[model samples]
Target: MINIEWKQPELILLDQTKLPTDIHYIRCTDWRQVAEAIKMLRVRGAPAIGVAAGYGLILAATEATQSNHPFSEQLSQFYEFAEELKETRPTAINLAWAVDRVLTLVKASISDNAITNGEALINLITKEAEEIHREDIALNHAMAKAGATLFEGQSNIRMLTHCNAGALATGGLGTALGVIRELHANGQLERVYADETRPLLQGARLTALELHEDGIPVTLQTDNMAAYAMQQGLIDAIIVGADRITTKGDVANKIGTYGLAVLAKHHNIPFYVAAPYSTFDFTLQDGKDIPIEMRMAEEVWNFHGIQTAPSDIGILNPAFDVTPHELVTAIITEQGVLKPDYEASIAELQSKVQK
Candidate 1:
């Protein structure tokens, strides 16, 4: 079964925090539930979060349909709810794009007598949301193949990755981790050194589990162990997935990605970011314009309600960090690999998709 799917109460999402040991599902029927899930990382990944928001719209529409509301009234209410959902997480463009896509579809589909059959609208909304999920999975596969070719002629490539950018992170397959999967399938992968991302441990909790389940050889290490591993000549390349990319080619990913980018530059190892074109934000000229989300401070001070640090101490938890364009060797997208002048290349890809 897919991790997130449309079901009765609303949308069914696999709680990612409870993965590897327990598979739990949270049924959400409203935008508040969707916002909470995104904020808590219960439903995560750039692509997956977007999909969740799209489904959230459908769920909200179901309520409107049941109330026997007119199509215009229902759509206005749903659009407002989707806008609120979009603001819950600022780092992922997929969330904004997905919500906007659904609203736009609703506006175009409605007419003077659109409410003639609310049931039909619900079915169409469900179909569009499913398409979002299906398309993301297909994109992951195509990008993985294109990215794996960049590591050609290099046998036994020892890779180091941070956070959970695997099938769990995307609708299916992954972004940067998808390339790692492709390499393993082609017999070029030797080992994967996964960083146990602190505060949340997404790497240890999610990435490691996904890779292990896939029968890939993976080792989990603390975030501090990355530079040490590179210095020991144990790493060949560094790969990561992005939450957002600016027109200037700056990247924003998990909090620890900036440090890894610096270490890769020092070690003279190539660092690559793999993502779909939806990740690129041509509106932002540089990383400075990208808003970094300051998460709840309690995440750093406690784990599952047990205090790990002094209770009164203050903690600043930024969900993501920016990686300079210079540190990234290249970016792998579904269309193909793109270079630093990502502004033009991203525009070209968007143009093609639009046509």
Candidate 2:
């Protein structure tokens, strides 16, 4: 299921905000519509956000070409557009990573005097954006197989996952869900327990639906039931996708991830976070420094406008929470699995990228 697609001149997104039941799609011929889709969670997930952002820039380029604007002015517009899309999601490092990826090519072209027209800029950026989309899918496949190796020799594996980290959350199979698919394919996994993530129910609404649609066995449960499930020894391992990972290996993921990691430690279950290297912010030293996105009070206040609480109730809904590296058993990547002493492991990963 290609959650995000670029059909040249326009960006089409699977409107995840209305998923499972509706199965709707949104077509954005303009960059602002794409940005709005991102802010509204009509298109979401870290990897998906990055991919969508790339296409958003492509859409901006398309519009710029039609406006008869000079190349210099259009390039400046692209820089401005990149910042606007990046600002749509503060927590996900990939949003900026992806947007900058295209801009780097554009910048390089400018330095070489290789591009003088808007059409040339469009060609360069569109190619890079398409490649980003392809690379994301390949990364998902590689990390899925790499992460699944950790559960080798185990049979009838029961895994617990939070939020929506499946295909709906990524450009391809998924990050965490990609590994789950591999395990299922190898006949090692028996079931997945999806947390009904509060405020949005991304788990129940997206993850569960995505898994079920893929023919994987999934059990939907409320967020609060996770502890009891762990106590009953129903969960074998926990794997999730990250929004941002610091060089120290602290992961910022869905708001409930920190509590799940704590539960995994108490039960001595191996906790895993599956993400591509692009999710890592080498600049940031710790998760505490990672910006957490504070969502609307209306989300916590009601169920899609149907009030569940008193009018004007005090609410603090943080979109993400930081999970310390110590709680994580391993960080799975396309290069390989990263073990503890994560600062050093991350340095090694960075070196490979630099090479």
Candidate 3:
């Protein structure tokens, strides 16, 4: 099921914060609501957030009128909207990448005098945002096929995944989950182990729900049980989606991904990261430079708004963590599976970069 949809005049989002129980959809007629949803985790996941941010820019553009301000002034307003949305989620590179993509395209069009007024500007942005949504769906499928090939000939393939990298998250089949779907479709999948990502439970609440709804056999386990499960030979491989990937192949994903990678290495299982081209951050040479967003302390100290620990307890709640390139088996992308020397593999990807 598609979690995010554009029904005109409103961007209908399947409120993820209320998942695994109520399938609620929140409508955003204004860009700020979309930005708030990203910040609130009401509409989350890297690709989903990127897709939402694109639509958010459209909403922001729709608010401006050529009669009220000059074209330059309207462009400035659009830039401000883009910056505000980008700030809502700092760890996910897709947020900034998608926003900058749309903005860059519109600016180039205007520079060539193709966009002469507010109406034209809005129309161009609408098409670009819609295209971003469509492209993400296609990328999901492409990456799935590329990633699934790695597990070919291995029947009853058992897989482990963290966070919510399913249709609900990616606006398409998924990244890691898409690969799982492909395996299931090929009659090769035995079972999937999903980690119940803490402080948010995106895996338990979102991944489990999606996999169950799709009739895929899924076994939910707490984040701490991952190593035990691996030691018991309950997991064959670890696959996850990335928030940001650096040029060195270091991955920034959900907070617990690094630990899982370490466990997978010990178990001699493949540790794969699935992501789209847009998720790559070319500016950062190393994952250490990738800014990790520190979340509110209450996210770790409380459960559903009820205090689960001392009220004054100190908490270091980082939303994401980095997995060094040495632990990664390969980086799955739409073009193909990237194997080390990532510099060489990523060269092919960098060739396709526009920005």
Candidate 4:
């Protein structure tokens, strides 16, 4: 279940697009190949994408090193490669965050003359990428512990989730799914109601697959069924993973997440978001400023390459949507579960990370 793997000079990614039906792997030896994989959804999820981008930079450095070109030329080429990787996906802040972190390290290495040759730079970048991968796993475990506390003294808690935020979606255990795993491990989880997220069905195809393989009880339902399930008292809580979180604690996640949050609030069910600190985009004042990625209409008009609608029909396929902070009962991170007065809480969490 290793979604993204870095084996020395190459990156191996599980082909997420062919999950449940076909198990396949895509090997990336070049940075452009890595970029294409991200664009094609061969490897996705916010944290996973960031980890892939870090390895992509390492691959770029490897190519630059082998060229035997002038140091200035190599550096310029690597920066261009970084920009290319950045453009692969705009909505997931983790992609840009991971790329920038590696770029920053590269620049610092050059300034201090710590990496004079391309070989040395490649080594340094690779180490950083590995560290990013390792830290994600640690963060996931910490977040799971913090999130599990919310269900203390409550047994057999039934939860609802959107999209595929599991081990396949990250470098570690997962974000939202990690919380679910922790609860299951503690014998507090009864079952999971997974939304068959449309246009892609990541929940049905990925989340359910992952949960089933792990022997976790899962019941898949169409996205529209979420509210009805809530009304029926089938769901005790709603937990989702975020691609981006604004300073005010507004969340940008899978497209149907906003609706789920609204339903949760109306039903008096707690709505929670789980993510690492890197998912936070503090520079943005709120969700309004966070960019939303619009995917191709073909994704909606066709199902597994079979036409589901008239080819000429108009379609809007936004990959994500924002949920206002008021609807979120808490935000779970490696630090702890952040409660309201989010602006202050977020700032406090960010400052601690800085220290």
Give the top-scoring candidate (lDDT). 4
Work out the TM-score per prediction. 0.95, 0.98, 0.98, 0.99
Model 4's TM-score against the true structure: 0.99
Q: Higher lDDT: candidate 1 or 4?
A: 4
Compute the lDDT of residue 298 as modeled in candidate 1: 84
lDDT of 1 by residue, 1-355 (tens): 3678877557888998787678899988776887899889998889889888878877767767676677667666766767788898998888988887777776666654544556776776788888998899999999999999898887898999999888888897999889999999999999999999998999998999988988899999999999889999999999999999887789999999999999999889999999987788867878978899998888899887788998688788999999989888989989999886767776777787667
Lowest summed lDDT across 10 adjacent residues in model 2 is found at 62-71
Off by over 4 Å in 4: none
Q: Tens digit of lDDT per residue, candidate 2, span 241-308? A: 99999999999999999999999999999999999989999999988999999999889878876999
lDDT order, best first, reads 4, 2, 3, 1
Report the lDDT tens digits of candidate 3 across residue range 170-232. Answer: 878999999999889989999999999998999999999989988999999999999999999
Where is model 2 more than 4 Å wrong at Cα?
A: none
Q: Write the per-residue lDDT of candidate 4 for residues 150-253, one digit (tens) a residue.
A: 99999989999999989988999999999999999999999999999998999999999999999999999999999899999999999999999999999999
Looking at model 3, report the run of 10 residues with the lowest lDDT sum: 62-71
Give the Cα lDDT of each candidate: 0.86, 0.91, 0.90, 0.93
Better of 1 and 3 by TM-score: 3
